[model samples]
Target: MLSRRRFLKTAAASTLCLTAAPAILRAKNLNSRLQIAGIGCDGKGWSDIQEMSTHGMTDLVAFCDVDLARTEMVHSLSPSAPIFQDYRELFAKQGDKIDAVTISTPDHMHAIIAIEAMQRGKHVYCQKPLTHSVREARQLSNLATKSGVITRMGNQIHSHAVYRNAAKALQTGMIGKVKQVQSWCQSTGHGKSGFIDRPKTNAPIPKSLNWDLWLGVAPERPYGLQDVYHPFGWRDWQDFGNGALGDFGCHILDPVYTGLKITAAPISISAKSTGMNDEVWPAQMTVHYVLPGNDFTTDGNLEITWMDGGLRPSLQGTHIPPGTALPSSGSLVIGETGTLVIPHYAPHVLYPSPDAKANVEKFVAEPSLNHYHGWVDGCLSGQQPSDGFDYGGRLTEAVLLGNIAVRFPGQKLEWNADQLKVTNLEAANKWLSRDYRSGWKLPETV
Candidate 1:
């Protein structure tokens, strides 16, 4: 992490830290392209590789996925690229050939893959909610700082023009001094919490799927049908996924963090859930945070609340426009002047309402950016990404903390950021991390 003085020095000099890290790998000549590898080459990984490999500076050289069916599709794209079912084998064999990697694996597997890749001097573009646990988030951040590797967390919308304008508007004071903010997403996974039971009878594992490789660092569990916990439904599981708030908090609250310049963890955080069991996420969750605000907020204090599972902020109760209806998934910014309602990645709406819906000239005037290419270029040029691990780790830490608070619903947990502990509740601190199953223990140092 760059110190405050270094940041100021760079800003005043109108320059960036373009010097390559000591561990960075670059061609002897400037004309060579980057050799890239895709881990979990399906779903988001498929799209990430599609976009990134299209860049003039990238070469898709390797693909890794637990499912042969998924790799078959990616294989057609880069037919010459080697394929592997396990990332460890891929790293061991192709370390010399790969320049950087894009990791889109499940939450539980992200840290180990990223750390191993980074330790070998490879840059990384990892998917969101950076890790499965808060402790891992902190560890990854420290490793990134120590290794000085180019890295980015996959919150793609962070680079979009809409979100960029929202952040700019706050910095520009278009919305006067934001005192409070509310963000939310639909609760498909959370709604399933009422029925907190896993399938007692294990379905036959698919021949096409490598269940053991897919499990990775996650504790051993019987594989069920894809509908239960394989391809998509794992988001509802306690062991494999990071619930709704864990999944979407990083993406939804990104603009708020950027706009308000939120640099520290929340002073305190707590949550209340309708009812949650060990099997699934809660049906409903309301997480509250008292953040240490920056220049964009009032008096160095701000209150931000997150809701899901058929919950929405009350615009009528707040300073927002009267009789306003909430969107299925979006954020509401409450300021002294008016409110700014952003519906996910779409355009933001201002309160007291703009006269012409088309008249957003004061808002967005720039073009959207390609997030995948930005990371690729950052690796090649030594330019730090906008949503790099330094920022993403802090955001992930807060989001994971909300998950911890959910375990002890209706109880406040005071955070000691510097110490990375729950100062008030010693018992609650245990939820920050878990003991890795035998072969899954994380190395103490990178």
Candidate 2:
């Protein structure tokens, strides 16, 4: 047998050779770029492209949209990239050429597109409030696990270092046991009332828009100037979108969920809304969710309240400093010992006292990272994404349940997590999963 020193030298040399060999080979393989495709090339989808391309190794292979004008516009920007009207055709024609897909369609189409892409073994980056309904969220989450494809939901707040650091602080008990969280969004309604009764007219579909395909997976309805392309304001409609809560809840409330790790379904959900009748979207709303308390203590409750459309709670005498503009969208966490305040769409600052200057130095600033780059890195490395389907599904469920509450405001909604059903109201249960139009069924994975 070889001496101990001689054997150790041989093993170390072999390890070094093996590690260096991969680096040498990777240098030769530098030509390989991640070929990515974008569906729904307007609105946030354009932003997704800009972010993904920042990594310098991603080639925008294709752009797909029902609107020809949007696809043309994206094609103009990426002259070398191919364009397609139907996403299915685009995938079929270029599946081998593409490495990943980013979906930024309306809520109703999120599950169908994302599920199909994942089934094809493609990594996915889907926009926030992950799905149109609670069932879709759960379905997508399970499918992501089964497919073994890297996935991320578009709750970009998780990518913010401040959000992560704040979560870490909360987890490490910096703020004591968090008992309550208040999250809100203040925005005007889409003002769809006056246009509701307009009679259907047989206007020619614009050359730039494939009107028939734009209404994918949704009920067939006549196309109108207000309905398609340009403004792309279908988000206010119940059939196509989940309204404001579904739009912003994922971004605003995501930090709280990240910090608390509150994965179990809400024990109860209740909503208070204005102008319930003759309204597809609530003029203003407030939703309350009851969650399990901190693990360190027993017999405690954590309440998360959501306010929107200029409807905010009484924050009088709170730790939020005077003269600081109260954020239109953000979270406030109330712990037993103190409070933590995060401003809307900005980095959070710890509030140790009501005075602006107290304990100012203890506040640690967090770095901001590109959310799209995080997903791309995870896709290439096989690591789990920061805001993966598991976290996103739970977040979507909480927000979509708020939509359910708005349908029948003031009624206490009982949720059965295991069964994934609303136990109290049968009429409300119907809204949990919608009927898909023919040829648009969301793919089911075994």
Candidate 3:
């Protein structure tokens, strides 16, 4: 088993070789023409395929999904590609032929499929939040390192020029001694409590869907339309998803964490909800994170507030200084000198008066590249990806901690990052890991 230190050293060495390859030699190598496969071929997965194709070197070779209809739909986009309903079979049969696998599946299945691919010597790109549980995130990161595979988390916004600029600006002290961060996702979907469970209904599974495979690492459960497709709402269920915080927190809070170089777990976490139930949604929910004060010595302390599902910070009380449209879903950084507001989705923007639109004087704007291709390019050339497993796992761990706070709403939870456990809440600590179904054990060290 590779120790964490050894794994990082190997990854760094591999990154050097990948990034130093000459353009002429790179173009001539057929092995460099990345043959890729897609799992969960609808929504983000479908779009990722299109984005990857634009890189000119990617060959869309296979598509997999529990829903046959989804696989067929994706096959239309790449008619020559083979299709499979089970990802395990797809990986086993075609692992060697493909250079990488892109997992844009629901949050729960991420670790199972990604770990399998990495063990088979295939690079992987799994969507964020990287895993359903904190333990899964750690395992995935460790496995990627052990297998010597290049990996990326699908927080695509991280590749945006503005996000990189935001980090650079903060690093250069453009934000001037940052102190507090406010991140939010104004979602109406998971209002109060997240997804309500379907009553014990024996609804027949869809003919086109393979129910067992969809459940993957989650506990075995009978299928329901509510559980599977249409409205595509599995995100609200605790069994297969992480609700709103898990969905948007990875993308929204990532920039702030990255710019700040926050690696340790929060010293404390607390949450409140307007709507509470046996299930996960709090209607509107707010989570507060008190990071260790030592990370930013100049700033006495830093706090990150996560708001979602109709819960949000009041613009009136915020320091935006009026006349500015509050960002619907993004982050607000309160620095010693001024504040910066960034948008949630694509085309992340910087804010506060003239700086919001003034061509971002210190930054460069360039056409966006596909995050999947960036990983492939990095792998083949031995360059480090911006959101590889180590960084991705950390980001996922941070966001998932917010989910843990929701699970133990109103409790002040203390975390021990080195031990990877919640120190103050014994009940909450139980959720740090999960039991995989039969035949689905994560490697002990990887």
Q: Which prediction has the highest TM-score against the true structure?
A: 1
Query: RMSD of model 2, in Å?
Result: 13.2
Segments of candidate 1 deviating more than 4 angstroms: 1-31, 191-195, 352-364
lDDT preference between candidates 1 and 3, better one: 1
My TM-score estimates for the predictions, one after another, are 0.90, 0.86, 0.85
Worst ten in a row by lDDT for model 3: 15-24
Cα deviation of 67, candidate 2, in Å:
0.5
Q: After superposition on all CA atoms, what RMSD does each candidate show versus the true structure?
A: 10.1, 13.2, 9.6
Ranking by TM-score: 1, 2, 3
> lDDT of each prediction vs. the true structure?
0.79, 0.73, 0.71
Give candidate 3 regions above 4 Å deviation. 1-30, 188-195, 199-203, 226-231, 293-297, 315-319, 346-367
> What is candidate 1's lDDT per residue for 176-198, written digit by digit as tens?
78888999888745443333677
For every model shown, the clashing-pair count is: 0, 0, 16
Query: With candidate 2 superimposed using the best TM-score fit, by how many Å does residue 50's alpha carbon deviate from the native?
Result: 1.7
lDDT of 2 at 421: 84
Report the C-alpha displacement of residue 105, candidate 3, in angstroms: 1.0
lDDT of 3 by residue, 219-321 (tens): 7766755434332677766777777788888888877877787776688888877755554455567899988754432556678999887555655534475
